[model samples]
Target chain A: MRILVAMSGGVDSSVVAGLLAEQGHEVVGATLQLYDHGAAAAKRGACCAGQDIHDARDVADRLGIPHYVLDREQVFRREVIGDFADTYARGETPVPCIRCNQTVKFRDLVALARDLGCAALATGHYARRVEGPDGAELHRAADPARDQSYFLAATTRDQLAFARFPLGDMPDKAAVRAVALRLGLAVAEKPDSQDICFVPEGRYDSLVARLRPGAVAAGDVVHADGRVLGAHGGIARYTVGQGRGLGAASWDGQERLYVAGVDAARRRVVVAPRGSLETGTATVGEVNWLIDPPSEPLRCAVKLRAREAPRAATVAWDAAAGLARVALDAPGIVAPGQACVLYDGDRVIGGGFLRAPGSVDRVPAAA
Target chain B: MPVLGLDANATEPLRPEARDAVLRALDQPGNPSSVHAEGRAARRLLEEARAAVATAFGAKPQDIVFTAGGTEANALAVRGLAPGRRVLLGATEHPAVLRAAPATAETIPVLPDGTADLAALEALLGAGGPALVCLMAANNETGVLHPVAEAAALCRRHGALLHVDAVQAAGRVPLALAGADSIALSGHKMGGPKGAGALLLRPGIDLAPLIAGGGQERGRRGGTEPLPAIAGMAAAALAARPEAAIRLAALRDAIEVGVAAAAPEARFPGRAAPRLPNTTSILLPGVAAETQVIALDLAGVRVSAGAACSSGKVAASHVLAAMGLGAEAGAAIRVSLPWNAAEDAPERFVAAWSAMRDRLSRRAA
Candidate 1:
């Protein structure tokens, strides 16, 4: 089979290409030029793509597989980056990685793979795709710490059908490095990219402010009862259940305060006690079901954030309104704009983005 | 299956004559500038190649300045000549010319047929102070031939200097450098090796050197000459015959006609214009150029679309866009026949392309 591997000039994807090539599968490596690396480097005098692209080309040359860099800067800006800033401006913490995976990595690359006469599009994502009786099924990786099923839950059924994840079954990231070492790949020791690919400095607040200035306006941090407690530099910096960075508003005399909700229209960060931030139900919109959309309430485990473990929940689907109401068995912190990924055992049933509590329509942008 | 090589405009396959000349030149080891016996031999070889190139291209031996390649030659001409004159560029010029042009340079538009809009050029030339007008003899992507002779007449009337980039047109066609002040040529684009290119200057044209290193090529360019590549280039130029254009044009037209027959919706940009004999730009209505190039490669045929970036990714063609191709600019792929292309290349290419079209169209629907 001819496979198109999305190489980010990293160890995991490099290992994926090497392993696939070793298995006698014809592999083509493609890296996305997501933004103007030259312009970005000029802004801070930083060298980023000059190394990554060279590394990718080096690895491809060593493996004897042809590699190309796809220029997706325009599409990435419009789809992922713009959506990311817009989500923040609307008082929701954005998962840019998910947006990139959903739009550019999975959707666009899958189409490109077909256009290039490839059997499937493969990547280094630590998520599994199993062949179900009906079709391909998205599942969590064997390594729990590295499982990226939540970030990939939004991949469409057609995309999942043509997607391959060669690194999903690895015992851990160390094992992936071991495979790289075994393959004699130089990228085995390349430090794993921890920050968002575009945010080289890991200062997303500054990036959001630069991209959408209206989202960074001064806002009042207030108590849930409407008593103004303190001022914040921007509402974008606050996420539900975050207790730190409240400064003088860290405590409300008897109890420590946490961000409960953000009111973008009013430019207010609503703070409350930790207990008050927990919610029994989270309304999720833009639902994508790997399995069939259940006509009845489905019992499953729901993860409300990337770092959190899945908790027991019952999800009721509202097909007409395109929303899923996830009722957590125990009240937990449900942050708006974070993914509400529902899992049954190790398989992802469906997922969607959580909406702000008590909001009817789409979350309105800041005034 | 033998891979059909159809991307001549990107870089032509080296001729046997050029390869032999390069081999012979490589055996000699002395700087052309050294004053010893070996140096005298090397200098004799260099001057011989220079004379050959000058005679082949209708220039004087002293007028030819060798540079790294087409890009450097263009930069030397545009930057060297544009100190006191306003720069005017053809809209469809290659990045070599475009990037070297001053930011304030005005663009001359092209007609729908991909030829330079002479009216626009005349108007711009008439509107300006003394200008250095840059135009390409043949567009790299579309192969559209600009009327350099006519444009040169217009430039002369306006007291402007005309520089024609003949990188693609040099070996394949009779160059229209009449009354033009300078011409740029690339070795690789004309069946020679990659490292050598030349800027031909008209007598009395004051050219400031792009590189201020050791005084060479009459102080018009600098650095030690790449003798082997330059020798190969001169040999290739001497081997090229203007009569060969007829044979290549027949093959090019066959590919275009066969492809149009196979895929009726296919549109050939610059088909009506006087284009380079070996180049054809095929535009498929709804398919992307990148996809077409890849699909063709997978099917054992090699073609190119637009300008490939440093990362080897195909970008939308600025040449086709300048000709008002609109969305078709991204959908066009250039099929330029090399000097030694197989007689059956057109059949093989058409077969592969139509099969790809059928598969992609079904998927698109």
Candidate 2:
């Protein structure tokens, strides 16, 4: 079998490519030039090929496989980065990694693999594709610490059928690095990428400011009880349920406050007590179902954010509206634009992006 | 299956005669500037190679200024000559020349068929202070020949200096440089090694040295000349056969016919224009050039599209965009047949290409 491995110049993907080739499969490596790393790093006169691309090419050479760098800058900028900034401007937190996987990584690469006549498109993602009774099913990695099924919740069934994840069954990062060392790959000791890939110096606020200036403009931090607490540099710097950066307004009569909401239209960061930040129901739009859409409400474990544990919830699917109403059994902090992925044990059942709590009230109810 | 090379415009395989000359030159070990007996022998070889290149390109032996490559030759011509003059560049000029020009330099647009808009060039010259007009003899992507002679005549009437980049045109076509002040040539593009190129000047035209070092090449270009590559270039130039290009045209035409028959949507961009004999730009209406290039590479055929950057990714061509290709700008791939292409080259490329087209098109459907 011939497989196209999406090599990111990292240890995990390099091991994936090496393992497949060692098994006598024809492995071709591909790296996406997602953005101008030189410009992102603010370096002057730097060549477009950064250290990551160079490492990817070197690893491909060592494996005796042909490697190609595909230009995806324009599409990535339009789809992932643009959506990220716009979501921030609308006073919502965003999972840019999800957008990247949904569009640039899976959808585009799967089509490219087909065009190149490859049997499957493999990646370094810590997830699994199992043959279920219905068809191909997306599952969590054996190592729960490195499982990335939450970020890959938007992958379509057709794309999942043509995708492979060799790193899913690995024990952990240390084991993957050991495989890299055994294969003599140079990225064996390379540190894992942190934060957002495009953010420089771990300061995502600057990137958001450069993209959406209106989102980062100075605004007032107001209490939910109509009191002007203080002034904030930007609404984008605050997310729902965040406690830090509220200086001077973080405590009133020894009662700690957290970010309750961001009113973009009013340019106000609304802060209140921790109890006020919790929500019982989250309206999630743009729902993607791994299994068939259920006719009635389905009881499952729902995850509201990437790092959070799955909570008990009853998800009601409205097929006509293409939205899922996730009713959490316990009140939890729900942030808009964050993904609400539903899971059944280690299997991903469905997922969607969480809408604002009052969005349903803005629309007339069905008679 | 052996991979067939179809990207000659990017680079050509070294000719055997040129390879021999390079090896022979490498055996010597003296700088041309040294005063020893070995240095005298090196100087003699250098002059002889210069004479060979001068004779082949219709220039005087003293007028050739050796540089590192085509890009250096172009930069020397532009940066050295455009100090007091307003630089005017053709829309389809290479980035080597475009980026070398002053920020205020104006662009002369090209026609829809990929040829330089001579009327627009004349108008820009007529309205000018003394100008340095830069235009390529042949567009690299489409191989469409520009009207260099006519543009040179207009330059003379307007008292402007014309610099023609003949990197892709030198051996493939007869260079029309009657009134042109300077011309640029690359060694590797004409079946020589990679490290040598030259800027040929008219009788008394002198420019500042881009690299100021120990005076060499009459102080026009400084730095120790890469003797082996220069020798190879001169040998390749002297051994070039203009008649072989005619045969290449037939093979190239056969390829277009086969590809068009296999995929009816295939369109040739510069087919109606007077293009180089060995080059063809095929545009498949709905397919991306990147996918096409990669698919063909995997099928034992190597081709290129757009301009490959430092990361080895093909970008959208500014040349095609200037020719008003619009949406089809990213859909075209350049297939330039090399000088030593096999007789069955057309058949092999077409078979691999059509099979790829069928598979990809079916997936699209």
Candidate 3:
């Protein structure tokens, strides 16, 4: 079978190409040159740069398969970087990677695979596709610790049809590393990359400064009661639930204040006690249903952050408004613009964007 | 054991004389910089090789400054040129030249035929003062020859020093360093060992040295020289002849005609323009270069997608991009033959290419 493997120059992608070729399948490795004009040797990892392409090619040569690099710099700038910068400008932190996967990586890659006459497109994502009685269902990987369902919840049913995840069945990272070592791959022991592929050092501030030089304006840091506590360099530097480096003098010392909300228009960071982080409900917009949309309010588990587990919740989809209002059984800090992924146990049902707290009308509970 | 060698662009098999010279140099125990008898012997071999390389390029022995390879030679040329003045380079210049020069340097455009545009270059030089002009003698991808002598003369009239990257042309094409201020050559490109190359610096042209370790290469470049590769490189240069050109050209012509018969729509760049006799850049539309290269490899034939140095990159070639070909650049497959390619090699390549073309055509239909 002919398989088109998407190599991102990361250790996982390198291993994916090696494994596919070793299995005697006609594998064609391709790396997407997402952002060609961007600075190289940046603090961020060189995921889709010239060096990455060289490394991917070296691995392809070692495996005795064909390798190609596709230039998608314009598409990346439009779909990922532009959206990310716009989201930040709107006083919200957006996951550009999720957008890239949904638009460029999967959608564009599927088209490339078809052009190459390959039956399917494969990636190194740590998510599984299970053939259940109903249809193909996306599920968490075997390794619970490294499961990436949060980032992949936005993937649609059609996009999942021609997709394959080789590392899905692997029990842990150690097992994957072991297979790479056994194959004598050059990147067998390469350290797993953590930060955003574009921002390796996690210095989003400098990147933002370079992009929008005068966009970040110094603003007042105010308490929940509207008392001016301190001044911040800019609201873009802060995120919900952040505590350290507040630059505020701790006079009262009652409790370390956490950023509860960002008022972009006023250029202010609203802070409150850590205990005040909890919220009873969240309204999700841009709802995407992996499974059929619930007929009514159904009890399930919802994950708001990457590290956070899916907690018990009641999710109600409003087709008229195109929104999903999720009521958590246990209150947590649900920030606006963050992903609200719904899960029925380990299977990802669907997800949507968390809307601002007071933007939706509350639905009454069951009498 | 028979090895299916596809990495010709990396380094060719060393000539027997070159190998023996390297072995002989390996027996000598003294550094060439040392003033002792053994040192003098090593120095004599090094100077003789330099002289041979100089004579091969129609240059004086003193004009040759030996360096690591083509990359360092290019870096020295680009970085050594006067700063603050505009630097003009051909769009197809190798990364060694491109990276060393500032990204904002003015690029001399290349025509669709893979030849440098003389009008654009003349205009660029005419409009600027104190410019360092760079143009390669032969493009590594399409094997297209640029008018370096013409460009160099134009630079000379404008008081600009021209650096010619003759790495691809050294043994394949006759080189005369009369008009250009400097020229770069790589040993591996001409069946010599790797890690040894030379930069031809015209007399009285002072420039900054990139490496300053020891007072080697007349205090222009520093570091311990790889004497074995140097000896091999000199012997290979001296032994290079034009007879291989005629043979390679005939084989290349046969391959081009056979491939064209098989795939009628395939386009070969520089078919009309001057190019390296042993190289051809064929474009197979709708079929990716990587796919064709692999198919050919499976059939015991080898080709490349653009230069082997930048083969793995998925991005379109900057040379192709500079020519405004855009995504079509991905369709280019470069087949570079060595000077001593076998008589039946072209037939073997044509047979393999026909099979691949049949498969691709059926798939397209």
- Top candidate on DockQ is 2
The TM-score of the first chain in every model comes to 0.96, 0.97, 0.92
Clashing pairs in 1: none
lDDT of 3 by residue, A296-337 (tens): 898999998778988999999887777888889988987766
lDDT of 2 at B20: 98
User: After TM-score superposition, what is the CA distance of residue B262 in candidate 2 from its true location, in Å?
Assistant: 1.7
lDDT of 1 at B159: 97
> How many backbone clashes does every candidate have?
0, 0, 2
CAPRI accuracy category, model 2 = high
How large a fraction of the reference contact set does each model reproduce? 0.48, 0.86, 0.28
Candidate 1 per-residue C-alpha lDDT over A232-317 given as tens digits, one digit per residue, 9 for 90 to 100? 98888889999988888989897899999999999899999988889898999878889888999999999999998899999998
Candidate 2 lDDT score at position B187: 92
Residue-wise lDDT of candidate 1 within B182-282, one digit each (tens)? 89999988899999999999988868898878998888887889999999999999998878999999999999999989988999999999989999999
TM-score of chain B of each: 0.99, 0.99, 0.95
DockQ ranking from best candidate downward: 2, 1, 3
Candidate 1 lDDT: 0.89
